[model samples]
Structure formats: C-alpha cells, structure tokens
Target: MSEIQNKSVALVTQIEGALADVSPSDRAQSFLERSLDLYFALGGPPEAAAKLVTQARSRAQLRVESAVANVVIELAAASHLSDIDMIQAAYNRLDVELKAERSKK
Candidate 1:
C-alpha cells in the first residue's frame, strides 16, 4: 500500500481497538479523539485530518451497523417469536450484550 493508505489503515485499526474496550455510548467521542490523535501522530496535515477522520468514521459505522444487523437477524430467527416480539426480543438481547460490554470496561 501507499504511505497514505498504510497510515489510514493504521488509524482505523487503532480506533477499532479503542472502541472495542469502550462503552457504546462513548464510541463517537472516542473515535473522533483517537482518529485525530493518530492522524497527527502519523504526520498528517491538520487541515486534512477532519476529512480523513470523517471518512474513517463512516467506514467504521457501516461495519458496526452491518455486524449488529446480522446479529439481530440471527437472534430473531433463533428466538422463534411473533414478528413484533422477535424484533423486541432481538433488541433486548442486544441491550443486554451492550450492558455486558459496558461492564467490562
């Protein structure tokens, strides 16, 4: 990869690692903070850091959303409840998982 591409990947990987240990409620702020810090640390221009962080954040959000949606679908199918109930159950399970994740931090 080119130098910029390598730095971008490193920034994303660092953010992902930071996010993994943080509560869901804190992810947005954490992502922003870590992204900027990494970008500067990598000798990126201050003017372009915001744009880079935005792109990285979008990619990260999409991955996280996709993963959550897949889990919800799997949970709903395994739950064997009515449509409405299944949705609610899936969300509830997700909430529980979030709580567990938070407690770990």
Candidate 2:
C-alpha cells in the first residue's frame, strides 16, 4: 500500500481509497491561490498567493522528498494527489472549520 493510502486507511478509513491526492492545507491554499490568481494574475494578493503556492509547493515537495531520503517515502510519493484528494481535503477542512465556528458560537 502507498503512503497516502496507508495514512488514510489507518487514520481515516472512511476516506480510504478516496483521498488519493491532496494535502488538506495545500488544497485549501491552492484554492485560495487560484482564486487570487484569477482576480489579480498580474499582481496584488492573487499574485502574492500564487507565489505562496509555488513556495509552499516546493516546500511541501521538499519536505516529503527529504523525509523519504531519510526514511521510507511510501505516502504521497512527493507527488500532487488528485481531485478526489482535494475534495476530501476540502470536506475535511470544512468540517474542521465548521467545528471551530460552532465552538465559537
């Protein structure tokens, strides 16, 4: 089993075989980045967010790559997952966000 699969099955079995691709934060951040990119592709917050996405992408990839170098890199394989992972991450993020919002309420 791949690292992502293992993580999903072990941690959130419900999302197993579902979250094939996507880091919750990365997906959320990417969504923000894309929206910003559309709003101000040339410059402004969108451009800034785009840069952040790039850097974060590199950082995320590097972290996984580096860790894999140190140990085993079965999970995620340092590759960007798929839309399902993104959707799963989004749903998970939404859940967390809702919980936080509810707690505040």
Candidate 3:
C-alpha cells in the first residue's frame, strides 16, 4: 500500500482497538462519535481528524463493495450464469444482505 493508505489503515485499526475497550453497555453513541472523542483525547486536531476519518471510511466502504461485487461475479461464473439481469439481481440481493447484517448489533 502507499504511505497514505498504510497510515489510514493504521489509524483506523488503532481507533478500533481502543473502541473495543470501551464499555459495551454504553450503546448510545455511534462509532464516529466515539472515534472523534478518542481522536481529540489523543491530541489530534479535530478538523484534520474528522477529514481523515471520513476519507478512511469512504475507502473502507469502497473496499467492501468491491469485495461483494467480486464475490457475486465469482459465484455467477461458478454457477455458469452469465445473464446480465440475473447477475444484477444477485448483486442487489447480496447488497441487501450486507446492509442488513451491518445494521445488526
């Protein structure tokens, strides 16, 4: 990975590790909210930290979507299904399932 990508991944991983130590009982705050709090606590500039987090989140989201698309393509090829409409429907179904799983605690 490039330096920026490596740094972003490291920062996100550090934030996630710290978040894991937070009390699970406190479920009121969202992850970004908590992550921002941690960033400020660690002496990072709020504006810069927010921008970094936003960029990292977007990259992570794209990676997930790409992975989903690859899986859909692989499955279609394995099943010998080459119809465009059917592949699109499969992708849509997988996207919905991914969203549903993400919504769960």
Candidate 4:
C-alpha cells in the first residue's frame, strides 16, 4: 500500500480497537469520524483525508448492516415461525432495536 493507504488502515484499526468496548450503534459513525480526524492530525492532505474518510465510512456502514442482517436471520430462525411470519417478526424486531439505538443518541 501507499503511504496514505497504510496510514489510513492503521488509523482505522486504532479507532476500531479504541471503540471495541462501545455498543454497535455508536461504532459506525464514531469510527468514521475518528479515522478522519486522526488522519488529518497525522498531517494527511485534504484530498487524501477525504478519500480515506469515504472508504472508512463505507466499511463501517457495511459492518453495521451485516451485523443487523445476521441478527435478523438468527431471530427469524430461532422464532420457529412460518415464512411470512418470520420475515415480519424479524423486521419488527429490527425496527424496535433501531428505535432503541436511536433513542440512546
């Protein structure tokens, strides 16, 4: 990797480690913001920093979405409901969890 890419990866790893104890809902945005801040503070240029931030944000979002999807799948499976009911219950649970997470902010 190039210097900026290396730095960006390192910063993202550091941010993830620092936020490891944090709740999932708080992690995505915090990871992106911290990566950007730390990159800039490390004397990265504006253009490079913006690129890094975009990449970081994309990664964080993907992780969060993946986790949510996994939970929905697990919940649906564990409920032993019919196909349609499983989908509905999974979505309802997701909605409630999302609202609860939002309220925490």
Candidate 5:
C-alpha cells in the first residue's frame, strides 16, 4: 500500500488498541473521530470521503457488542476523572462533526 494508506491503517490499528481497554461507546466515538480526521487530512476523490465516513460508523457499531459499557467507564479507566469530562466533551464534539458531515450526504 501507499504511504498514506499505510498511515491510515496504522492509525486505525492504534485507535483500536488504545480503546481496547476502554468501554464500547467511547471506543466507537474515539475511533470515528480519529478516522474522520484522517479521512479529511488525506482528502482526494469524493469516493474517499464516502468510504471514510462509512468505515467510521462501521467501527462504532462494531463496539456495541463489546465488554466495556459506556464512555464513562472507558474514560475513567483510561484517564483521570478530570480528563474524563474532557473526553466526553471531545466525543460530543466529534459526534456533532460527524453528524454535520453525514448531513451533507
């Protein structure tokens, strides 16, 4: 694969691993944000944008069956309580962004 493709794949892997010890919802939201950023960063054909969002949502739903329950548990286990709020805020921001991006479709 090309370097950019490699980078994207690596980022996906890293996101997954980072959130593996986390809760399902958090993992989904985090991965989606990370993927969306990479998708935007590597802008190209419209096809890429379409595929990127689809893949991101796919990753999110895949976490529904996961062991971790919600974003809080994941955040608390992964970081300090102070940072937990930040993580939720971040996830909310990403959720808004993703919704906007999807609305354009």
Candidate 6:
C-alpha cells in the first residue's frame, strides 16, 4: 500500500489499541495524541498535515466548481443544452484543467 494508506492503517491500529482501555476520556486523548504525533512525524510542524488536508479539500472543491462553471458557460454560449451533450464538453474542460494543474506541479 501507499505511504498515506500505511499511516491510516497505523492510525486505526492505535485507536483499536486505545479502545481496550477503561477510561473514555483517556482513550480519546490517547487517540488524538497518537494521531498528532504521526502527523507531526510525517509533516514536520504540528499543523502541517492539517493545512495540507485543508488545501487539498479546497483545491478539489475549486476543481469541481470550475468544471461545472465551464460546462454551464459553454452550454449557455450555444444557447441550448440537451440532456447529455454537455457531458463531453464538461469532461473535456476538466481534462484541460487537470493538465494545467499537473504542469504547474
């Protein structure tokens, strides 16, 4: 599996280990501490992983919104939208956007 997937599995294992403890608050605190330690190990700063996750989610949302806007504008320019014709145009625009993002990377 990938590095992130391996980290996720380790997180699950940590939570499972904590589940057998007697105190609920201790278990929760332990889980959070373990998770934060892993994030710090992987991302350096305490908040680095969280920032990366937030940025990734924002980027994904922007991509979806951009693709939808492109579809609507392109279809509107043609003055009519059928039930299925806009699918190809929208996907083509998303493909272009993906290429652009990849090039920047």
Candidate 4 TM-score to native: 0.28
Model 6 RMSD vs true structure: 18.1
Instruction: Sort every candidate by lDDT, greatest first.
Output: 1, 4, 3, 6, 5, 2
Clashes of 1: 0
Which model is ahead, 4 or 5, in terms of TM-score? 4
Q: How many clashes show up per model?
A: 0, 5, 0, 0, 0, 0
**Model 1, 5-104: lDDT tens per residue?**
4544444454355435656666568655854664565466988866875786687456667865765575465455334465454456555655665576
RMSD of 4: 18.8
- The per-model lDDT (C-alpha) reads 0.57, 0.48, 0.54, 0.56, 0.53, 0.53
Highest lDDT: give the candidate number.
1
Global CA lDDT computed for model 6:
0.53
- True-structure lDDT of candidate 4: 0.56
- TM-score of every model versus the real structure: 0.31, 0.26, 0.28, 0.28, 0.25, 0.24
lDDT at 48 for candidate 6? 67
* Deviation from native of the Cα of residue 68 in model 5, angstroms: 18
The digit string of per-residue lDDT tens for model 5 on 48-75 reads 7777667856864635535334644654
lDDT of 2 by residue, 1-105 (tens): 764445434444243335558466645564455556434633446346567767866753556447545433322232133223543564575567556655754
lDDT of 4 at 39: 53
Stretches of candidate 4 off by over 4 Å are 1-23, 53-105
lDDT of 1 at 45: 92
> Candidate 5 — which pairs collide?
none
Residue 5 displacement in candidate 2 (angstroms)? 25
